[model samples]
Target: MGNPVQRPLPDIEDPLYQAHFQGLKDQQLRVQQCDACGQLQWPPRDLCKQCHGDRFHWPVMPDQAVVYTYSVVYRAPHPWFKEHLPYAIVVAELENGLRLLGNAFGADVEKIQCGVRVKAHFQHDEDSGVCFLRWVPTTS
Candidate 1:
Protein backbone atom coordinates (compact mmCIF):
# COMPACT_ATOMS: atom_id res chain seq x y z
CA MET A 1 0.00 0.00 0.00
CA GLY A 2 1.12 3.51 -0.74
CA ASN A 3 2.01 5.68 2.21
CA PRO A 4 -0.24 8.59 3.02
CA VAL A 5 0.89 11.79 1.32
CA GLN A 6 0.95 13.39 4.71
CA ARG A 7 0.51 11.77 8.06
CA PRO A 8 -1.78 13.40 10.59
CA LEU A 9 1.00 14.16 13.03
CA PRO A 10 0.68 16.56 15.92
CA ASP A 11 1.54 20.23 15.46
CA ILE A 12 5.05 20.38 16.81
CA GLU A 13 5.28 24.03 15.88
CA ASP A 14 2.82 24.99 18.59
CA PRO A 15 4.70 25.92 21.76
CA LEU A 16 2.05 24.22 23.90
CA TYR A 17 2.68 20.80 22.35
CA GLN A 18 6.36 21.09 21.46
CA ALA A 19 7.85 19.68 24.64
CA HIS A 20 5.58 16.66 24.60
CA PHE A 21 6.68 15.74 21.09
CA GLN A 22 10.31 16.49 21.87
CA GLY A 23 10.16 14.04 24.77
CA LEU A 24 8.74 11.35 22.54
CA LYS A 25 11.58 11.88 20.10
CA ASP A 26 13.97 11.27 22.94
CA GLN A 27 12.01 8.18 23.99
CA GLN A 28 10.69 9.90 27.09
CA LEU A 29 7.18 10.82 28.11
CA ARG A 30 7.04 14.45 29.23
CA VAL A 31 4.17 16.22 30.91
CA GLN A 32 3.58 19.71 32.15
CA GLN A 33 4.11 20.33 35.85
CA CYS A 34 2.72 23.44 37.41
CA ASP A 35 5.46 25.34 39.17
CA ALA A 36 3.04 27.04 41.50
CA CYS A 37 1.05 24.06 42.79
CA GLY A 38 3.08 21.07 41.51
CA GLN A 39 0.16 19.77 39.54
CA LEU A 40 0.94 17.44 36.67
CA GLN A 41 -1.18 17.60 33.55
CA TRP A 42 -1.30 16.27 30.00
CA PRO A 43 -2.10 18.01 26.70
CA PRO A 44 0.01 20.88 27.88
CA ARG A 45 -1.82 24.10 28.38
CA ASP A 46 -0.77 27.70 28.98
CA LEU A 47 -1.90 27.47 32.59
CA CYS A 48 -2.55 24.81 35.21
CA LYS A 49 -6.08 23.67 35.67
CA GLN A 50 -5.69 23.30 39.43
CA CYS A 51 -4.31 26.67 40.47
CA HIS A 52 -4.32 28.60 37.22
CA GLY A 53 -0.55 28.62 37.39
CA ASP A 54 1.03 30.06 34.29
CA ARG A 55 4.55 28.88 35.07
CA PHE A 56 5.29 25.23 34.31
CA HIS A 57 8.05 22.72 33.73
CA TRP A 58 8.28 19.76 31.41
CA PRO A 59 9.07 16.65 33.40
CA VAL A 60 9.73 13.22 32.01
CA MET A 61 7.05 10.83 33.19
CA PRO A 62 7.38 7.14 33.96
CA ASP A 63 7.05 4.93 30.91
CA GLN A 64 4.69 2.51 32.57
CA ALA A 65 0.93 3.02 32.60
CA VAL A 66 -2.36 1.19 32.98
CA VAL A 67 -4.97 1.08 30.27
CA TYR A 68 -7.92 3.04 31.62
CA THR A 69 -10.03 2.69 28.50
CA TYR A 70 -9.85 1.86 24.80
CA SER A 71 -11.90 1.53 21.64
CA VAL A 72 -11.41 -0.38 18.40
CA VAL A 73 -11.96 1.72 15.31
CA TYR A 74 -13.59 -0.23 12.51
CA ARG A 75 -13.77 2.79 10.26
CA ALA A 76 -10.84 5.06 9.55
CA PRO A 77 -11.83 8.70 9.80
CA HIS A 78 -8.87 9.75 7.68
CA PRO A 79 -7.71 8.05 4.53
CA TRP A 80 -4.21 7.86 5.94
CA PHE A 81 -5.44 5.53 8.67
CA LYS A 82 -7.54 3.27 6.44
CA GLU A 83 -4.76 0.71 6.32
CA HIS A 84 -4.71 0.62 10.06
CA LEU A 85 -8.38 -0.05 10.55
CA PRO A 86 -9.38 -2.07 13.59
CA TYR A 87 -6.60 -0.54 15.66
CA ALA A 88 -7.22 0.35 19.28
CA ILE A 89 -7.13 3.93 20.53
CA VAL A 90 -6.25 3.89 24.19
CA VAL A 91 -6.41 6.26 27.12
CA ALA A 92 -3.76 5.13 29.53
CA GLU A 93 -3.32 6.45 33.05
CA LEU A 94 0.30 7.07 33.90
CA GLU A 95 1.78 6.21 37.25
CA ASN A 96 1.56 9.89 38.14
CA GLY A 97 -2.23 9.86 37.60
CA LEU A 98 -2.12 11.73 34.32
CA ARG A 99 -4.02 10.18 31.43
CA LEU A 100 -2.60 10.30 27.91
CA LEU A 101 -4.16 9.16 24.67
CA GLY A 102 -2.19 6.82 22.43
CA ASN A 103 -2.60 4.17 19.81
CA ALA A 104 -2.04 0.45 20.44
CA PHE A 105 -0.90 -0.15 16.91
CA GLY A 106 1.55 -3.02 17.38
CA ALA A 107 -0.27 -4.83 20.15
CA ASP A 108 -2.93 -7.47 19.75
CA VAL A 109 -6.21 -5.59 19.83
CA GLU A 110 -8.01 -8.54 21.40
CA LYS A 111 -5.70 -8.48 24.41
CA ILE A 112 -6.39 -4.81 25.17
CA GLN A 113 -8.81 -4.04 28.01
CA CYS A 114 -9.25 -1.82 31.01
CA GLY A 115 -6.51 -2.17 33.66
CA VAL A 116 -4.05 -3.81 31.27
CA ARG A 117 -0.45 -2.77 31.74
CA VAL A 118 1.22 -0.86 28.94
CA LYS A 119 4.42 1.00 28.16
CA ALA A 120 5.42 3.90 25.98
CA HIS A 121 6.33 3.08 22.39
CA PHE A 122 7.87 5.87 20.35
CA GLN A 123 7.51 5.82 16.60
CA HIS A 124 9.78 8.24 14.78
CA ASP A 125 9.15 9.33 11.23
CA GLU A 126 12.47 9.93 9.52
CA ASP A 127 10.84 11.76 6.68
CA SER A 128 9.16 14.40 8.79
CA GLY A 129 11.44 14.27 11.82
CA VAL A 130 8.38 13.72 13.96
CA CYS A 131 8.00 11.25 16.80
CA PHE A 132 4.71 9.73 17.84
CA LEU A 133 3.95 8.19 21.21
CA ARG A 134 2.24 4.85 21.06
CA TRP A 135 1.37 2.19 23.64
CA VAL A 136 1.72 -1.58 23.67
CA PRO A 137 0.82 -4.28 26.18
CA THR A 138 3.55 -5.03 28.66
CA THR A 139 4.62 -8.62 29.17
CA SER A 140 4.89 -8.05 32.88
Candidate 2:
Protein backbone atom coordinates (compact mmCIF):
# COMPACT_ATOMS: atom_id res chain seq x y z
CA MET A 1 0.00 0.00 0.00
CA GLY A 2 1.22 3.47 -0.85
CA ASN A 3 0.49 6.88 0.65
CA PRO A 4 -2.78 8.52 -0.26
CA VAL A 5 -2.63 11.21 -2.90
CA GLN A 6 -3.27 14.82 -2.02
CA ARG A 7 -5.32 16.58 -4.65
CA PRO A 8 -4.69 20.19 -5.52
CA LEU A 9 -6.90 22.66 -3.74
CA PRO A 10 -8.56 25.61 -5.36
CA ASP A 11 -7.80 29.20 -4.39
CA ILE A 12 -10.61 29.98 -2.01
CA GLU A 13 -9.08 33.34 -1.19
CA ASP A 14 -10.00 34.79 -4.57
CA PRO A 15 -12.65 37.38 -3.76
CA LEU A 16 -14.52 36.93 -7.01
CA TYR A 17 -15.11 33.23 -6.36
CA GLN A 18 -15.11 33.16 -2.59
CA ALA A 19 -18.88 32.98 -2.42
CA HIS A 20 -18.94 29.92 -4.60
CA PHE A 21 -16.49 28.06 -2.39
CA GLN A 22 -18.29 29.20 0.72
CA GLY A 23 -21.57 28.03 -0.72
CA LEU A 24 -20.16 24.56 -1.24
CA LYS A 25 -18.91 24.52 2.31
CA ASP A 26 -22.43 25.34 3.40
CA GLN A 27 -23.90 22.60 1.18
CA GLN A 28 -25.47 24.93 -1.35
CA LEU A 29 -24.69 25.72 -4.97
CA ARG A 30 -24.27 29.41 -5.53
CA VAL A 31 -23.97 31.27 -8.79
CA GLN A 32 -23.62 34.93 -9.67
CA GLN A 33 -26.82 36.68 -10.61
CA CYS A 34 -26.86 40.09 -12.21
CA ASP A 35 -28.75 42.37 -9.88
CA ALA A 36 -29.52 44.70 -12.72
CA CYS A 37 -30.99 42.33 -15.27
CA GLY A 38 -31.59 39.11 -13.30
CA GLN A 39 -29.12 37.06 -15.29
CA LEU A 40 -27.42 34.10 -13.71
CA GLN A 41 -23.80 33.50 -14.58
CA TRP A 42 -21.03 31.09 -13.68
CA PRO A 43 -17.25 31.47 -13.12
CA PRO A 44 -17.94 34.59 -11.09
CA ARG A 45 -17.07 37.85 -12.79
CA ASP A 46 -16.77 41.55 -12.04
CA LEU A 47 -19.49 42.47 -14.51
CA CYS A 48 -22.52 40.65 -15.78
CA LYS A 49 -22.03 39.25 -19.26
CA GLN A 50 -25.67 39.57 -20.20
CA CYS A 51 -26.31 43.19 -19.28
CA HIS A 52 -22.83 44.36 -18.36
CA GLY A 53 -24.12 45.09 -14.89
CA ASP A 54 -21.51 45.80 -12.28
CA ARG A 55 -23.71 44.72 -9.39
CA PHE A 56 -24.29 41.03 -8.70
CA HIS A 57 -25.66 38.71 -6.05
CA TRP A 58 -24.92 35.15 -5.01
CA PRO A 59 -27.92 32.90 -5.27
CA VAL A 60 -28.32 29.25 -4.42
CA MET A 61 -28.79 27.14 -7.52
CA PRO A 62 -30.60 23.86 -8.01
CA ASP A 63 -28.54 20.73 -7.43
CA GLN A 64 -29.95 18.70 -10.32
CA ALA A 65 -28.48 18.89 -13.78
CA VAL A 66 -28.12 16.99 -17.04
CA VAL A 67 -24.76 15.92 -18.31
CA TYR A 68 -24.13 17.97 -21.44
CA THR A 69 -20.81 16.37 -22.23
CA TYR A 70 -18.15 14.22 -20.61
CA SER A 71 -14.74 12.68 -21.05
CA VAL A 72 -13.04 9.71 -19.48
CA VAL A 73 -9.40 10.47 -18.79
CA TYR A 74 -7.41 7.27 -19.05
CA ARG A 75 -4.11 9.02 -18.35
CA ALA A 76 -3.49 11.21 -15.36
CA PRO A 77 -2.52 14.76 -16.20
CA HIS A 78 -0.66 15.16 -12.90
CA PRO A 79 0.88 12.88 -10.32
CA TRP A 80 -1.87 13.72 -7.84
CA PHE A 81 -4.44 12.36 -10.26
CA LYS A 82 -2.66 9.08 -10.95
CA GLU A 83 -4.75 7.17 -8.43
CA HIS A 84 -7.87 8.52 -10.07
CA LEU A 85 -7.08 7.26 -13.52
CA PRO A 86 -10.01 6.63 -15.83
CA TYR A 87 -12.11 9.22 -14.00
CA ALA A 88 -14.93 10.98 -15.73
CA ILE A 89 -14.91 14.72 -16.17
CA VAL A 90 -18.31 16.11 -16.89
CA VAL A 91 -19.90 19.34 -18.00
CA ALA A 92 -23.43 19.39 -16.70
CA GLU A 93 -26.15 21.91 -17.50
CA LEU A 94 -28.36 23.08 -14.69
CA GLU A 95 -32.05 23.70 -15.05
CA ASN A 96 -31.34 27.39 -15.45
CA GLY A 97 -29.13 26.62 -18.46
CA LEU A 98 -25.91 27.29 -16.58
CA ARG A 99 -23.16 24.79 -17.20
CA LEU A 100 -20.69 23.68 -14.53
CA LEU A 101 -17.61 21.52 -14.88
CA GLY A 102 -16.75 18.93 -12.26
CA ASN A 103 -15.48 15.41 -11.80
CA ALA A 104 -18.01 12.60 -11.78
CA PHE A 105 -17.19 10.80 -8.57
CA GLY A 106 -18.32 7.24 -7.80
CA ALA A 107 -19.29 6.83 -11.43
CA ASP A 108 -18.43 4.14 -13.94
CA VAL A 109 -16.29 5.99 -16.44
CA GLU A 110 -17.34 3.61 -19.20
CA LYS A 111 -21.03 4.25 -18.53
CA ILE A 112 -20.92 8.02 -18.40
CA GLN A 113 -22.59 9.65 -21.38
CA CYS A 114 -24.29 12.80 -22.53
CA GLY A 115 -27.85 13.58 -21.41
CA VAL A 116 -27.41 11.61 -18.20
CA ARG A 117 -28.87 13.08 -15.04
CA VAL A 118 -26.55 13.96 -12.21
CA LYS A 119 -26.57 15.75 -8.89
CA ALA A 120 -24.10 17.88 -7.04
CA HIS A 121 -21.98 16.10 -4.44
CA PHE A 122 -20.01 18.23 -2.02
CA GLN A 123 -16.79 17.00 -0.46
CA HIS A 124 -15.10 18.91 2.33
CA ASP A 125 -11.40 18.84 3.13
CA GLU A 126 -10.77 18.71 6.86
CA ASP A 127 -7.23 19.99 6.63
CA SER A 128 -7.85 23.10 4.51
CA GLY A 129 -11.52 23.67 5.28
CA VAL A 130 -12.23 23.80 1.56
CA CYS A 131 -15.25 22.22 -0.05
CA PHE A 132 -15.31 20.75 -3.55
CA LEU A 133 -18.34 20.12 -5.73
CA ARG A 134 -18.47 16.85 -7.63
CA TRP A 135 -21.10 15.35 -9.91
CA VAL A 136 -22.68 11.95 -9.31
CA PRO A 137 -25.03 10.00 -11.52
CA THR A 138 -28.62 9.99 -10.34
CA THR A 139 -31.37 7.50 -11.05
CA SER A 140 -34.12 10.07 -11.24
Candidate 3:
Protein backbone atom coordinates (compact mmCIF):
# COMPACT_ATOMS: atom_id res chain seq x y z
CA MET A 1 0.00 0.00 0.00
CA GLY A 2 1.12 3.52 -0.77
CA ASN A 3 -0.01 6.98 0.14
CA PRO A 4 -2.25 8.73 -2.33
CA VAL A 5 -0.66 11.34 -4.48
CA GLN A 6 -3.22 13.89 -3.39
CA ARG A 7 -2.71 13.12 0.28
CA PRO A 8 -0.36 15.55 1.94
CA LEU A 9 1.72 14.60 4.97
CA PRO A 10 4.60 16.18 6.80
CA ASP A 11 8.15 14.95 6.21
CA ILE A 12 8.49 13.35 9.62
CA GLU A 13 12.03 12.11 9.02
CA ASP A 14 13.45 15.35 10.34
CA PRO A 15 14.15 14.92 14.04
CA LEU A 16 13.64 18.57 14.87
CA TYR A 17 9.86 18.30 14.54
CA GLN A 18 9.57 14.65 15.44
CA ALA A 19 8.69 15.45 19.02
CA HIS A 20 6.00 17.83 17.88
CA PHE A 21 4.36 15.15 15.80
CA GLN A 22 4.79 12.62 18.58
CA GLY A 23 3.07 15.00 20.93
CA LEU A 24 0.17 15.29 18.52
CA LYS A 25 0.00 11.53 18.16
CA ASP A 26 -0.25 11.33 21.92
CA GLN A 27 -3.11 13.92 21.88
CA GLN A 28 -0.96 16.56 23.55
CA LEU A 29 0.02 19.92 22.12
CA ARG A 30 3.73 20.48 22.60
CA VAL A 31 5.95 23.30 21.47
CA GLN A 32 9.72 23.28 21.54
CA GLN A 33 11.31 25.51 24.13
CA CYS A 34 14.90 26.39 24.86
CA ASP A 35 16.14 24.25 27.69
CA ALA A 36 18.65 26.89 28.64
CA CYS A 37 16.78 30.14 28.14
CA GLY A 38 13.23 28.89 28.69
CA GLN A 39 12.08 30.50 25.46
CA LEU A 40 9.62 28.80 23.15
CA GLN A 41 10.34 28.42 19.44
CA TRP A 42 8.48 27.28 16.39
CA PRO A 43 9.08 25.39 13.10
CA PRO A 44 11.59 23.40 15.13
CA ARG A 45 15.34 23.86 15.16
CA ASP A 46 18.43 21.80 15.89
CA LEU A 47 19.71 24.19 18.57
CA CYS A 48 18.17 26.85 20.70
CA LYS A 49 19.33 29.87 18.75
CA GLN A 50 18.69 31.95 21.84
CA CYS A 51 21.33 30.17 23.94
CA HIS A 52 22.63 27.46 21.59
CA GLY A 53 21.39 24.79 23.96
CA ASP A 54 21.05 21.28 22.55
CA ARG A 55 18.31 20.25 24.93
CA PHE A 56 14.60 20.73 24.23
CA HIS A 57 11.61 21.34 26.47
CA TRP A 58 8.19 19.97 25.61
CA PRO A 59 5.35 21.51 27.56
CA VAL A 60 1.67 20.73 27.30
CA MET A 61 -0.16 23.59 25.75
CA PRO A 62 -2.78 25.34 27.85
CA ASP A 63 -6.42 24.44 27.35
CA GLN A 64 -7.53 28.03 26.91
CA ALA A 65 -6.79 30.28 23.97
CA VAL A 66 -8.25 33.03 21.86
CA VAL A 67 -8.29 33.55 18.15
CA TYR A 68 -5.57 36.02 17.37
CA THR A 69 -6.28 35.97 13.65
CA TYR A 70 -7.81 33.76 11.00
CA SER A 71 -8.61 33.33 7.35
CA VAL A 72 -11.20 31.52 5.32
CA VAL A 73 -9.51 29.21 2.87
CA TYR A 74 -12.07 29.20 0.09
CA ARG A 75 -9.30 28.42 -2.35
CA ALA A 76 -7.14 25.48 -1.43
CA PRO A 77 -3.48 25.41 -2.36
CA HIS A 78 -3.39 21.63 -2.06
CA PRO A 79 -5.60 19.08 -3.78
CA TRP A 80 -6.50 17.45 -0.46
CA PHE A 81 -8.00 20.70 0.78
CA LYS A 82 -10.32 20.91 -2.19
CA GLU A 83 -12.41 18.16 -0.72
CA HIS A 84 -12.71 20.11 2.50
CA LEU A 85 -13.11 23.47 0.91
CA PRO A 86 -13.90 26.64 2.80
CA TYR A 87 -11.94 25.81 5.93
CA ALA A 88 -10.82 28.13 8.70
CA ILE A 89 -7.21 28.38 9.73
CA VAL A 90 -6.69 30.22 12.96
CA VAL A 91 -3.76 31.53 14.93
CA ALA A 92 -4.77 30.87 18.49
CA GLU A 93 -2.95 32.77 21.21
CA LEU A 94 -2.60 30.80 24.38
CA GLU A 95 -2.54 32.30 27.85
CA ASN A 96 1.26 31.95 27.87
CA GLY A 97 1.84 34.26 24.89
CA LEU A 98 2.38 31.26 22.59
CA ARG A 99 0.48 31.11 19.33
CA LEU A 100 -0.52 27.90 17.58
CA LEU A 101 -1.68 27.73 14.01
CA GLY A 102 -4.27 25.07 13.49
CA ASN A 103 -7.42 24.41 11.54
CA ALA A 104 -10.53 25.33 13.46
CA PHE A 105 -12.56 22.18 13.97
CA GLY A 106 -16.09 21.87 12.52
CA ALA A 107 -17.88 22.54 9.24
CA ASP A 108 -19.30 25.94 10.01
CA VAL A 109 -16.33 27.80 8.68
CA GLU A 110 -18.10 31.12 9.00
CA LYS A 111 -18.44 30.81 12.73
CA ILE A 112 -14.79 31.64 13.40
CA GLN A 113 -14.66 34.84 15.38
CA CYS A 114 -11.52 36.70 16.33
CA GLY A 115 -10.95 36.85 20.09
CA VAL A 116 -13.28 33.91 20.49
CA ARG A 117 -12.31 31.35 23.09
CA VAL A 118 -10.90 28.05 21.87
CA LYS A 119 -9.32 24.84 23.08
CA ALA A 120 -6.90 22.31 21.66
CA HIS A 121 -8.11 19.02 20.28
CA PHE A 122 -6.79 16.11 18.22
CA GLN A 123 -8.30 14.84 15.00
CA HIS A 124 -7.34 11.66 13.20
CA ASP A 125 -8.36 11.09 9.59
CA GLU A 126 -8.42 7.34 9.31
CA ASP A 127 -9.23 7.39 5.62
CA SER A 128 -6.40 9.71 4.76
CA GLY A 129 -4.08 8.24 7.38
CA VAL A 130 -3.27 11.56 8.97
CA CYS A 131 -3.62 13.34 12.28
CA PHE A 132 -4.04 16.96 13.19
CA LEU A 133 -3.76 19.23 16.19
CA ARG A 134 -6.97 21.17 15.75
CA TRP A 135 -8.46 24.04 17.71
CA VAL A 136 -12.15 24.07 18.47
CA PRO A 137 -14.08 27.07 19.62
CA THR A 138 -15.42 26.86 23.10
CA THR A 139 -19.18 26.83 23.54
CA SER A 140 -20.56 30.20 24.43
Candidate number of the best lDDT: 2
lDDT of 3 by residue, 1-140 (tens): 67545656775555887777778778888889988898787766888878888899888777679999998888889977887788899899988887888886457768898999988888876764456877788887
TM-score each candidate: 0.92, 0.92, 0.85
| TM-score: model 3 vs. ground truth | 0.85
- Taking the tens digit of each residue's C-alpha lDDT, what string does model 1 give over 1-140? 67556778777878888888888899999899999999998778888999998998999989999999999888988877787777899999987788999897744886789999999899899988999878889897
Query: After best superposition, candidate 1 residue 118: deviation in angstroms?
Result: 0.4
Report clash pairs, candidate 3. none
- Judge candidate 3 against the unseen true structure and give its global Cα lDDT, from 0 to 1: 0.80
Off by over 4 Å in 1: 1-3
Clashes within 3 Å, all models in order: 0, 0, 0
Candidate 2 lDDT, 16-108, residue by residue in tens: 898899999999999999999999998888999989999888999999999999999888888877777878899999998999988864547
Pairs that collide, model 2: none
